[model samples]
Target chain A: MENGYKLSYLDNLESESIHVMREVFAEFEKPVLLYSIGKDSSVLLRLAQKAFYPGKIPFPLMHIDTSYKFVEMIDFRDKIPAKENVNLIVHKNDKYIKKRMHPSKFGMDKCCKFLKTKSLLDGLSSGGFDAALGGARREEERSRAKERIFSFRDQFGAWDPKNQRPELWSIYNARINPNESVRIFPLSNWTELDIWHYIKKENIEIVPLYFAKKRKIIRRDGLILLADQFNSPKEGEEVEEAMVRFRTLGCSPCSGAVESEADTLDKIIEEVMIAMNSERENRAIDYETDGSMEEKKKQGYF
Target chain B: MHKEKDLLRLVTAGSIDDGKSTLIGRLLYESKGIYKDQLTSIEDIAKKKGEKEIDLSLLVDGLKSEREQGITIDVAYRYFSTQKRKFIIADSPGHVQYTRNMVTAASTADLAVIIIDARKGVLEQTKRHSFIATLLDIPHILVLVNKMDLVGYSEDVYEKIKEDYLQFASRLPTHDIQIKPISALRGDMVVKKGNNMNWYDGRTFLHYLESVNIVSDRNLIDFRFPVQTVIRPNLDFRGYAGRIESGVIKVGDDIAVLPSGKKSRIKSIETYDRKLDKAFTPQSVVLTLENHIDISRGDMLIRQRNVPEIRDELEAEVCWMAEEPMEEGGEYLIKHTTNTVPVILKELRYKIDINTLHREEKKELGLNDIGRVIIKAQKPIFFDPYVRNHKTGSFIIIDELTNATVGAGIIWYPSATLPETENSQ
Candidate 1:
C-alpha cells in the first residue's frame, strides 16, 4: 500500500481509458461520444475532457432521447454541452413520438427499438461518424464479458460475436470499411465499484435521481416503477410514495427503482458494497430471456 | 479514503474438461465476487438442466452458443479484487482452433495460469498452452493440477504431473513456474485450504495469485513514448500527448523525437489533475518541450542517448488468426504503437509444430498456426525486441481487404544483417 511511485488500480484504469480516448480521436476521421447522461456517461465525459485537456473535446456528444426519460435526466442532459464547452446532438425519433409510441401501448421491445436503437443508427449514419465512443463496461453483464474493447460492427450496425478481431496488448486495430464502424469502449475494464470510487474521488456531478428521494412509485411484477407523468397507476394498482433510487437510468418506464436511503455518495457506495443484487437486476430489458442483452447488442443496441 | 490497490492481469488456458471454468468460478464465488442475482440465475439454469448441484461453469460461459456447446468460444474477461490487488482474468478457450483467442489473452497478461487434469498428466494441449505462455513472454506461470479429488488427492500423482510438466517446460524461456494440486468441484485449495491435501503443503491458488511479485515485470529502465496526437489548444500551447510505454520521464530531461532525430529538453508534464514533476510507464500525459520540434502522431520520443533500433525490415514470430491462409508476398497494413504502414510478407521461414516444438518448412500459415516470417515495411519503425519490451515490440497485422486483425506478431529484432534480396520460395 505504500507504493506511492506506482499507480493505483483506479489510476491505471483511468490511464488506459484516456489512452483509448486519444486513440479514437487520432484514428477515426469522424468520431462521436454516445452520451447516455447516466453515471457511466458522466465518467466517460470526464475522461474525454481529461484526455484532451486545455482544449475542447475533439468530438460531439450524441444522446438518443427516447422521450420517456425522467424529467430530471433531460434537464441535466440539456445543461452538459454548455458547461463542458462541447457540442451536443440530441437525436429524438420525432416520427415515433408523433405516432405516440409507448412501452405501455407498444411493447418495451418495439418502443426501445424505434426510439433508442433506430434513432441511434439514424443519427450516426447522418452524421457520418466512423467510430462511436461509449461507456460500456464488460463487468456489467454476462455477454459483455466477451466483447472486445474495439468492437467491430457491420455496415448495418450488426455485431458478429463469432468473428471478433484479436485485440493484443495495448495495440488496437481500428481499421474498418467505409460504411462499417467500431464501438470504442474505454471503460471496458472498470467495475461498478471502481466507477463509484472514481466519481467520489473526482467529485464528478451526476443525475440527482441516483440519490434517494421521496417519489411516487408503483410495484409491478416485482419491479418498482416511478409513477410519473409518463407512467401512472393502472387499474387496481396502488400508487405509493417511498424513498427509492434508481441503480441505472434508462427510459423511466423500463428502468426500475430500488428502495434505499443512501442519499449521499458515501452512503451510496456503502450500500453498493453490501447490496445483494447486481446493478443490472433492476433493468427490465434484460429480463426477457437468458441472452436478451446479446440479442440486443447483435442488433446494434448499446 | 482508502489506499489504492495495484492491478494484475492473468490469463487461464487449458484444454476442454480441465476444470478451467470451474476453477475461475470457484475463485469468484469464494472471494464474494459473485453477486446474489448471478448465483440465482446459475442455480435456475442448473435446475433446468436437472443437476443436483449448481454448475459453476455456467457463470463464465456467458454466450448462448457456449452454453449449448459446453465450451468457451472466445476470450471472456472477468474482474475481481481482494484487499491487496485487483485482478483481470482473461478466460480463453483451449480448443486447437481457438489458439488465436489464447494469444489475444496472453498479449497483456503478466501471468498465465495453465490448468492440467491430474488424471491426464501433461497432455499435448498442456504443452501447447505452455509453449504459448512462454512464447508470449508471460512473466509467471502457475500450473494447477486440478481434479485432485477424482485422483484421490494422491501425492504421487500430483508429483508425477508436476515433474512431467517441468520436463516439458525446461526448454521454454519462462523461468517462474509454480505447480499445485486442487479440486475445482470440491473447492479444495482454490480460495480456502481444504483438509484433503495434507501432504501437499504450499500456498493455495488464490494466495499465490494475491502474493505473487509482479512489480519488476515492467521495463522501467528504458523510456519510450509514441505520440498519439498533438494537443494544440491555442497558438501558445503545443504539447505531445501519449502514454509512456516504458521507463520514466521528468522535467528538463533531454529527449529525442524518433525518425526525425530532433532533440529537445522537457519543459513540463501536464495532466488533467495537475502538473507533474515526473511520470512513469503507462501514464497518459501531455508533455511540452523547451524547444519547438516538429512531432506529430506516429512519432516516438525517447532519451537522446538511448534509442531503439530503426529499421524497415523485421524478423518476427506471427500467429495467424484469420480463417484464410496467409498469401505469400501479400501486402497488408502493419499497426505498431501509433504508426500504421504498408507491409509485405517477405518470407515464411518456418512453422512450429505445437505438439513437438519442431520447426517445419511451410509455405503458408493457416488459422491458429504459429510461424516465423520476414516482413518489409514501407517506412522505418522504431522498436525494441519483444523480449526486451512488450509494449514497443508488438504489432498487429490488418487484412487490407477485410480490415480484420489477421495476425499477431512479436518482433525478434530488426533484420538488417539478413540479405535483402534473398527471396526463398
Candidate 2:
C-alpha cells in the first residue's frame, strides 16, 4: 500500500521487526535467533525469512529445551527443520536434565534458571554468539516496559536495569564488548492483540494446541495443566477432559491453559479483544513472587 | 482519508509532577488495554500502603530501580490501540539529567506529546524537551497543558501558557504545533472531552491520535534503499534486501548503486513472499537486478537521477551520552545506514547552550552534551540531510575501545560554507 493507501498496523510492525533482524544480519556476526517455537517466535522466524527472503537465514536458530514443554511444541519444532533450510540447533542442559530437574522438585524460578537461563547461556557461549534475537514484547509485562530495542548485557549476561544505552530511531547501536551479548527484541513494540491479528493475516502456522481441544486436564493452583506423560494428577487430585486452549506456551509444569472455545483464528482474535486479563497472567513463573520477571531478567533470563 | 491507520509512535516528555505517567495510564485504562488482575493488584498494593491515589505512575515506571528511585531512568514503552490505529508510547524520564533519554525517545516518534503542568507554565524543562523534540525533527507536537484542575480549569491559564509556548517554539524548527489544555488525572480532554471544559473546543487526545494525518508524513520521494544483506538462499535466486527509506520503485525500473556507481535495472521487487507491481517507502523488500552487479550490505540502490548526497566528511549536531568527554581527535565508528566506517572528531565547531539556545564555543562535549562537530569518515557514505529524511541522515558513534554507543549525530550540511569534502583545510 502506498500513496493515499494506508499501511495496516500489522504491516508497520512487520516492517519494523524485519528492519531489526536486518540490522543484526548487517551489523554483527555470530548472531543467533532464540527460537521458542511459540506464536511470537514463529512470527519472528517468518520475519527472519522475510528479512533474508529467497535466502536461508544466515545464522542458526537455537532452542534451549527444558524438556517440560508440551509435546506438540516439540513436534512442531522437529517438523520445522526438515521442511525449512534454516540451521536449527536444539540444546538442553544435559547435566541438569539427567538430575530429573522439575518445578516440583526445585521451585519454578530455580528450574527456569537452570533449564532456560543457564542452558541458554551455555548454548550461546558455546556457539560463540555475540547477539541473540528474541521474541519478547513490551506489552507483556510492566518490568518489560524499560527494555530497549537492543538491550545490552554485561559480561555475565545480566541486564543492568539502570544503565541502558539510548536507542535512537532505526540507527541501533549494535556495538558491544566481546564478553557482552546484546539481547535484541524484534517484537518489543507489538502487543498481544497485534500478534494475534498478524497471525491471522499471515496465516502463520502455530501449534494446534493453541486452538480449543478436548484433552485430559488437572486443575491445581488455579491452573489447568495437561495430564500427560510429563504432567499427571496427584493423589486425590481429579483429572478430567476439558475444553481449553493455551494463552501462552511454556514448560507444561508451569504453563496454564485458559477456558475457551476459540478454535479458529477469528475466534481467537475475538476472544483476545474481549479478554480482561493479561496473557502473562496464565504464566505461573511470573506469579512466583513480586518482580519475578525483572529479577529473572537481571539474572539473564530471557 | 486512508482506509486504514498505521502505527503511531509517540513520546510523552514532561517535568516531574506533570502527570505524564497518569496520562498514559489513563489512556491505557480507557482503551481497555490494562488487564483486570493488573489493576486489582495495583489497587490492592495502593490500599495496603495506605495511599490515597492509585499512583498510576507505578504502571509506567516498571524497572526495579525506577520504582525504588521514584523516577524513570530510561525510556519506558507502552502499547495501546483503538480500532483505528495502534500506538506505542515512549514514556521518557522527566528529570533534566535524562535529556539523552528524551532525545532517544523522540528520534523515531511521528508525534510528541509535550506535557506541561498548567500551574507551572513554560518552565526550563518544557523548553528543553520542546527544543529536543524539534531538533530531532519530530513532525507533530501536541502540547498538553496538563493538570488544568489544579488551576481551576481556567481558559485564561490555558491561553496564557499556549501563547508563551508558541512564542518559545517559534525560535525552533517545528513542522506542526498544536496546544490544548488537559487534566490527565481527572480524565478531562484526554480520551473524551471533559464536562468542565465547556468553553474550550478541540479534538480529544485519543481522537486526534486516531485520526491524525500520518500517511502524508512519510517521505515518498528520493528513493534511498540501503542494501542490508545479499539474499542468496540458494543457487537459483540472488536478491538484494533492505527496507525502502523513501520513494517508490517498480519492476523494470532503472537504478544506480551508490559508492560503486554501478547501474542496473530492477527485474523484480520481491517482498520476501511474492513479487509486487511496485513497492513504496518503508516496505522491506528484496530486488533482483537485470545484471549481476557488485552490491554489498553498505551499498544503496537509488533512482539514477534522484539520489542522496555522497560525502566523505560532514558537519553534525551530536548528543554525547558517554560518561567521558568527547575528544577532539577521537576515532570512533560512525554507523550510517548499513555502513559502519571509522570517523574522527576533526573539529568541535560549537556547542549549543540549551539554556540560551545559542551556539557557544566548547572544546569537548561530556554526557548529555549537544554540540556541533566536524566528522571525517574513512570513506564516502551515501546520506541525506537530517532535515530532508531522518531515516537516511542520522547515525550513531561507537567508541572503538569500549564498543559503547558514545553519541548520536545528525548529518548536517552547513549553510555558510561549501561541502566539507571540497574544502582544502
User: How many clashing pairs does model 2 include?
Assistant: 1
lDDT of 2 by residue, B1-425 (tens): 11155789999899998888888888988888788877876787689789977888888878766767777777888888887887888888888456799888999899999999999999988899888987888888999999999999999999999999899888887468888888988889998797999989899888889877888778888889999888876777889888898888889899999988989999999886688888887888888999998888889999999978787889899999999999998889988888889999999999997767999887989999899999888998888888778988899998888878889998877555445552121
* Candidate 1 residue runs with Cα over 4 Å from true position: A1-4, B1-3, B414-425
Query: CA lDDT, every prediction?
Result: 0.90, 0.86
- Writing each residue's lDDT as its tens digit, candidate 2 over A251-295 gives 998988998999998899889888899998889888777678999
Q: Which candidate is the best by DockQ?
A: 1
Task: Report iRMS (Å) of candidate 1.
Answer: 1.4
TM-score of each: 0.97, 0.96
Worst 10 residues of 2 chain B by lDDT: B416-425
Which whole-number lDDT from 0 to 100 does residue B221 have in model 2? Answer: 82
Please state the error at residue A90 of candidate 2 in Å: 1.5
Candidate 1, A10: how far from true, in Å? 0.4
Residue A143 in model 2: lDDT: 84
> Between which residue pairs do clashes occur in model 1?
none
Give per-residue CA lDDT, model 1, range B58-166, as digits (tens): 8888788788887778888999888888899998888845579889999999999999988899999999888898889998999999999999999999999888889
